[model samples]
Target: MHGRQQPAGHRFRRSLTAAAAAGALLLTAAPALAGDGGGRGGGAGGGWVDRQLSRMSLEEKVGQLFVTYAYGETADTTDPDDVARNRQWLGVDNGREAVEEYHLGGVVYFAWSDNLREPRQVAGLSNGLQEAALDGDGARVPLLISTDQEHGVVSRLGPPATQFPGNMALGASGRAADARKAARIAGRELRAVGVNQNYAPVADVNVNPANPVIGVRSFSGDPHLAAELTAAQVEGYQSGRAGVAATAKHFPGHGDTDVDSHTDLPVIHHTLEEWREIDAPPFREAVRADVGAIMTAHIQFPELDPTGAPATLSEPIMTGLLREELGYDGVVVTDSLSMAGVRETYPDAEVPVRALRAGVDLLLMPPDLPTAYDAVLDAVTTGELTEERIDRSVRRVLELKHDQGIVARPFADVDEVAERVGPPRHLTAAQRISDRTTTLVKNDDGLLPLADDGGSVLVTGWGASTTARLAERIDARAGSATAHWAGGDPTPEAVDRAVAAAEGHDAVVVTTSGAATAPGQARLVRALLATGKPVVTVAVGRPYDIAHYPQATTHLATYSYGAVALESATRVLFGEVAPRGTLPVMIPTADDPGEPLYPFGHGLGYRR
Candidate 1:
């Protein structure tokens, strides 16, 4: 939910490749001490952080609490995405300018910011920004570069790197260790690209089927399962080997909500007892495991704070509940203050000050950095905000940077990045995880394994790229197959064309996304059923994709459309790989709310 799309405009910078990356690493190697670990952030006295804090001015210390965004939307452009209203959301038109002009603490990247073709590009961008932030008499504290590399569909930098299966896929596989390994791989790769903080391993327990945002992002509906996996992921991401700070997110929880806070505020009506039982487990477990950071959610909890404020700006929730009750002293980051859920209400400069007053440590991507910064400064001048409070936040932020070793080694070697981004071992692990996550929900008439000798097969629906890949992969394993595509939510003519094209095919393999909310996809699936062929439908995104069309001969849910997940599903279709994944979530087909069509922990496999 952090990024909508990438900015397609080109940068005037040099194009970086693997070979060039080797030379860049060699060149950077000479400045290792100065760039990364040469100097002392804190001397042997251990009071170095106190010494650093003692010398800082009010303006510089206050600046340490705020982290704005740098979209890198081209070297010079207002908004490269071309969205009309996004013109105002644009901040830090120049990354270097933001550092010198604002004396900022950190920067969070979006897909548009990176627009990266390779890992070297990110390394170059990060190093350049760090140089600017550490300019003469600058903050001296290195920039805390962060991004939402949550894997799955929310990847900010996953193209040339390994794209592993997301949380739900790991949840379905029923292995906490696998979840940890996935996060470890993601962490190592992110660090290789010079990003230290990963806002991932969503600790939400998705108990609501109608949840629009966190369906596949959450681990499970059960609180126990969510806690176990969330702790494992945090441990993996924060492992000394990976060396990246992992953040547990959307505190208290974003699950069981019908509304998406990215657009509007969602109200949680659960009691404090319910919160203890359902939503608080994973966060507690994460804190117990010493997770690096915890992100606050925009959704309001009526029980937690009767003031009707979101957790991001609630003293009771952020300070009283999380800090005192849960005993979590790590960094508490807000989930993008730029989100409409909070921005629409506080469209003024007062947002940041109020958040600080509410006990938030790091204000992430304030709607307007200049306005927010000035507002906080004014609050201090008026005695509304205490210098002591500012000092606390600045100290915590600096401590985290020191803990991450960013104060010394702030630059990434492009050669090491290119080599370690997606190693062969990681690719194999991803494929294995994908193979194990292919959940077979149904096999009517024992359609379990397609006949290896079957004739021409028809693979279609949800677009040409999807059907073409599925058809090709199946054909390579079994026999020849042809494909048709509706491009999702098809119009009448497209549906009629699909029916007319399904004439001589022996079997129909239809893959559709958005089967839960979009009735058009369900209608398309029904139209394919009219052909009377063995319609083997695969739900590519949500598990509930099959609830709309239960008449299909087989139903499979892959939880994602990532390359590995798709390839693994193709293997299982032809029995080249056996289906081993259990359902991470329940699928509802009927109007009643009593029981789901297929319960959680339910999945079938082919013995042969």
Candidate 2:
């Protein structure tokens, strides 16, 4: 659920306020130095990263290549005090100590302080953590700060900050430009708060509607559409000219999986040819476009890597195919090693060692950093993992740092950074996409464009009656309309209310939020249809959910519940904007469930 812990109380607030002020002052005075010139000659300080790596012993070098998670004994807090306390407790306070003592290559920020609600708090937290990483003289490689900010469901930065729709919403909109805009906005926002890397632009194509975790996260079920949208997002995020690096992820693909990798390791049964035709296209596009990094998925593909290990720790997947065949020379990072896919399948230390041998340069979110570090060290010491292999990984890691400008300039002013991060233009872009992408699936009987005359109107379903945006649109259309929110499941009380309202109104409108298969939502649709009044059902989730209430007089699928999607749906309902969006995926019915419900490019327009 929630990640990390937070500090609480006035003391925490005061401390954070002070730290932010101090960090702001430091930023103003030191200002980030341009990579053009200054500091350390060709060998001494000039090539400090190289000099330091060369000096590190085999154990130290192995340690330098690891990026570990910081765990604590508490509910993930966002409070500033918890952040301060966790920093000390998790050994994050001495980043310099960890790096200098163990020769750690990088540290990933996972359990952050909860008090980081405002932009200033984020700046302060990053500044303080980075300060700690530089603690002991000049022995540490600059730590890489990362977060999973994949908009919709996987957003770390909350409130006051702009949040965009998930990938499925973008797919429904039928526009690649919107996807690119979303990425650019996300990139600038991330860079503003001192996050250098964003683990996003989910390249997975959700061909299976039953996919639980990645339903809305994926771009589209169609491989070509997914590739086109992914490429657009990559270009957009990198267009800001900020040093932020974007990672196209879960390669070779995680779309067709019905099982969640968090609990169990799911297998990809597609053959190499099937992969090349469907899954590999997006990854190849990303590789050709020169993405900064590629993250391996935790899914096991027996057809590809017969060892039964997930791709994250597979040499055949990471090295032979991605490196030799695809020619990707950028940094190769692993997914979190804590997932059951890695833990349940292999020995603790073996995952990291095998991952490295498989040509992975960075080990992310290991179960135990120190133990994992020692294991790699012991392997190198025993000549199990050659020094040459260590050098290869370290070199790639350092080169990435240099390219990202992290090695050249350690830090920047948080306030100035904030200015570049949340430009109003980005939010506007999100709003634009949300407005354009929402579609109207079907509207039979021409019952839409409710009579302008004021009358009792019943609005049911999740998005139509619950979401503030959709509710506002419906209320705006009818001067004095009464809305009864079904809340995903309509009870007898809800049904009675709907019937009561329908008794006084001309018609009833029921809307569904999320997908059709959402628990109890289908029952609400059946209940509304049972009322026997002229009923209009609108689907505000994916188009596939429309098959449930086929008996309804009117049915419309907007393919999304995002703000923009709601706006477009309202426009179609009010006869303002003609329904132009076509179905990108097939929606299956019970009788012909095996056949595509609404084939690709299915739409209905009101002809005046």
What RMSD does each model have against the real structure? 12.4, 13.2
Q: Which stretches of candidate 2 lie over 4 Å from their true place?
A: 1-52, 55-60, 68-116, 409-412, 417-422, 449-457, 463-469, 481-483, 488-509, 513-519, 532-538, 552-564, 575-580, 590-594, 606-608
Task: For candidate 1, list the clashing residue pairs, or say none.
Answer: 33-38, 36-408, 36-409
Per-residue C-alpha lDDT of model 2 across residues 261-353, encoded as one tens digit per residue: 888888876655566666776778887766777888899876566667788877667765677557777777888887887788678888888
After aligning candidate 2 to the native by TM-score, how far in Å is the CA of 19 from where it should be? 62
Model 2 residue 243 lDDT? 44
| Candidate 1 deviant stretches above 4 angstroms | 1-46, 73-93
Instruction: Show the lowest summed lDDT stretch of 10 residues, model 2.
Output: 2-11
Cα shift from native, residue 481, model 1 (Å): 2.5
TM-score of each: 0.88, 0.82
**What is the lDDT of every predicted structure here?**
0.75, 0.66
lDDT of 2 at 164: 80
